[model samples]
Target chain A: MNILIIGAAGMIGSKLTNRLIADGNLGGKAIDKVILVDVVEPTAPADAPFATETMAADLSSPGVAATLVEKRADVIFHLAAIVSGEAEADFEKGYRINLDGTRFLFDAIQAADGYVPRVVFTSSIAVFGAPFPDAIPDEFHHTPLTSYGTQKAIGELILSDYTRRGFMDGIGIRLPTICVRPGKPNKAASGFFSSIIREPLAGQEVVLPVSEDVRHWHASPRSAINFLIHAATIDGEKVGTRRNLTMPGLSVTVGEQIEALRRVAGDNVVARIRREPDPVIMKIVEGWPRNFAPVRAPALGFRSETDFEQIIRAHIEDELGGTFVA
Target chain B: MNILIIGAAGMIGSKLTNRLIADGNLGGKAIDKVILVDVVEPTAPADAPFATETMAADLSSPGVAATLVEKRADVIFHLAAIVSGEAEADFEKGYRINLDGTRFLFDAIQAADGYVPRVVFTSSIAVFGAPFPDAIPDEFHHTPLTSYGTQKAIGELILSDYTRRGFMDGIGIRLPTICVRPGKPNKAASGFFSSIIREPLAGQEVVLPVSEDVRHWHASPRSAINFLIHAATIDGEKVGTRRNLTMPGLSVTVGEQIEALRRVAGDNVVARIRREPDPVIMKIVEGWPRNFAPVRAPALGFRSETDFEQIIRAHIEDELGGTFVA
Candidate 1:
């Protein structure tokens, strides 16, 4: 089986790539070839069992998607997008890279008529805006508040339409905020969700931007990668017309996350978290959905952590090699 | 105030144009100019109190929208789109005119460097797909079953995004089916909705293609025209970020429609209706919305007929000079 991973240079992309290589197969079929691509050149896996190619290409630019589609990878994972904070900051760049870029890829696939492939697109919970219900259902309408959310919602719409038209077999999964990220803090509005747990566990001080009561949906990086794999291998017929799905997630407040952190590590680790209210990020995050009643994903066999503790545990095991600063 | 109506030759567009001329004002402001456009050359009103210009322009064509936007009409009504059946029949034409054409107009306005006009976009209930509730709420997610619906939904998304970016002051109203339509039977799947009432009242035979229980939401052409004017005049501030809204309409079944027709045009006129079930058209109409809880539009002061009789009455008064063939 041949596989193609777009946006293969990102953390989740790299993790997914390594997982596929380690397994040496996908959906019980042996992985014979893999192509990794992003705006920046992706690194080829070392000592690989299959022929792997990595290249840098801007999807928004014409002809780039055509080249990728011409390769005719059996299963395509389109995870490339401008991040939320950056997309909102730069409107033109956001629309070009996220909206137009994704369109280019879909159109290129259509251009190669009769070469239908399984396309797994990464959408986000940002598609849901504020004034949300306590637990948003699977069929909640997308009223995006930010440019990033708008672009992602549009991506979902386009992918679903293309799939319906038989241009491709597509599934768009709206991911929850990933917690305990294994890296330095970024400028994302959701960064605090990860940083509070990740930094403290690593014996470093972290700032809490929002209040303790501020809640949001989350999953471990492991679940996210698993969602991608599951999406690629599932029976597309079962998804029916509603291809874009709100993924299952653990909805918890900052207090619960701290409690989970305190339980996992010692009190000393919990003390590393410093509360510093950021009204800007708080206001932005306030409009985000705190939870979802994602019946579709769960019924489709995609699972995630039930509690915040398991999420932090998964992060420790996956990102920290089963160890932390303690 | 200057006004621009794209697709001015269409039924709703023509009604809106004549209404604007009759009133000679919009939101209490004197109407001085009206630019009407469609795929075919629109007919300019003779001896109008305002300067009326009529022209034909394919908006999807490059530079067409730019010219219209450069003129900087203070209130622009974008009502151009292929019907649902036509869009389903012709995919490229649907996307070209509905999606790309709408985007062109928004982009053109943006390109003019901050010429933000009040853009009243006419959306439709077709945006909602099948397996719907008895009464679709304002928050219902759009999973359009047809290409025309998909294009309209996409147009709503684009206009909302553009509005958010300050490119234009926009409001999209999802109009219900206009019942008691004044014209010969067209090939539209929903044409029977109007034809059943119109043809019978005009001493012509009309086929009832579906069952008596098939329910749908509807309004009069006058109500549709009022919707456009209200969308133009309503304070955009009230709409906030979610600019697209489902318009109010009378929710009645085909049986109720026949009852209203019998009441209006007498039993003799209603006898002209012939029952002939069409599986194809029935399948299409089956996916339509039965009713709507358009909380937003009502809150914004947009109103429609409370009962189907009022709808039929409006058609007779407006189209038949206050009398029917009976």
Candidate 2:
């Protein structure tokens, strides 16, 4: 089986690629080849038994999607997107890449004629918006508050439509904010969730934007990758007409996260977190959903970490040899 | 005040135009100019007091949106769309006109260099999908089962984002299926609702596609026009961050509708209806929401006809001079 991973250089994309390579096949089929495409060239695995190819090209560019699909991938994981903050900040670029880019890819797959690949799309919980009752159920409206969320919601719609039309078999997984994302901090408002722990563990002071009681939903990077794999392997018939499902994640307040930090790394690491109270970020966070009742996804066999401590532990094991330097 | 109506040649669009022209203003603001645009020439009212300009151009085409906004419309009623059945039948055309067309108009308003106009977008309850409860609430999730619904949901998203960014003040009114729609019948799955009564009232036999027990949400054409106008004048602050609202509608089962027909035109007209069960239309209608709890829209001053008999009477009075030949 041949697999293609778009946005293969990014966090979840890279991890999924590595896992697929290590496993050698998805669902017992031997992997013949893997094509990795992204705007930035992906790091090729040093030791891979399967044939691997890498390409750095912007999928949003006209004809790029068709050209990429020319190789006829059996299964495609479209993980590319401009992050929420950047997409919101740059309106034209965001829609062009997120909306137009996804459509182009789907259309390209359809244009491939005889080939119908299983498509796994990574959607986001940003698709849900405010005035939400404490814990949002599986069937909350997709009234997105941001351009990023809107784009994700549209992507899910297009994916479902194309699948319904028999162009491709598609599954859209609406993932939560991935906590403790490894590597340098990014510009996303939710970055603080990671920075509070990541920066502090790296012996640096971090700012907490909102009050300790501010709550949000999250999953670890590992869980996100797991979702992608599961979505790719699962039977599309099981999803039926409802092609998108909100992935499960832990719901924790910033205060509880701080407490988790204290329990895991003691008072020193927790004390390194400073409260500056940036109202702009706080306001953005305010409109976001704090939790989701991912009943559909859980019933479909998708799983997530139960709490924040487990999230921190996963971060340590995956990124830092299960040790905190601070 | 200048008013712009996109898709002015369409069925509801023409009716709305006539109403607006007949009234001369909405909310007491005299409409000085009526810019009527569509892919086809609109039938302009001969005695329209306002200076009427007709432009037969597709809004989805490049620069069309900016050109429309350049005329400095104080209020825009965007009613353009490919019908549900047509859109579902043609994927590319659907996305291009519905999704990209809406996006272009939104971006055009934003690109107007700070000219913010009141944009009243006509959305649809088709945004909701299957496994729906008896009555869908305003908080229901957007799991659009069809491409048409998906496009509308995406349009709603863009509308909200543009509103939030202050590019243009947008209000998306999710209209229920307008029953007793005047004029020639089309291929919409819900057309039978109108056809059964419309044909029989004309002393013609009408075929019912599904069982009489199938219930669906509906509004009158007058009510639909009312929604557009109300959406134009209502205070955006009252709508807050969520720009889309489900318009108030009367939910009636097919049997109830036929009963109303019987009450209005006697059993003779109702007896002309023949029921040959169609699983195809039945399956499609099965996913549709039977009713809606439009609590938010009503509190904000939006209203609808209270009874189904009133709806039938309104149709007769407005379309058939309060009498049916049959």
Pick the DockQ winner.
2
In the predicted model 2, the residue pairs found to clash are A140-B141
- Candidate DockQ values, in order, are 0.70, 0.78
Tell me the spans in candidate 2 whose CA falls farther than 4 Å from its real position: none
What lDDT tens digits, residue by residue, belong to model 1 across residues B21-58? 88999999999899999989998889678999988999
Q: List candidate 1 segments past 4 Å from native.
A: none
TM-scores of the candidates are 0.98, 0.96
Q: For all candidates, what are the clash counts?
A: 0, 1
**What's the distance in Å from true for residue B237, model 2?**
1.4
- Each model's lDDT comes to 0.89, 0.89
DockQ, candidate no. 2: 0.78
Model 1 residue B13 lDDT score: 88
In the range A14-105, model 2's lDDT, one tens digit per residue, is: 88888887798887889999999999888788787799999998999999999889979889999999988889889999999998899899
On the 0 to 100 scale, the lDDT of residue B85 in model 2 is: 82
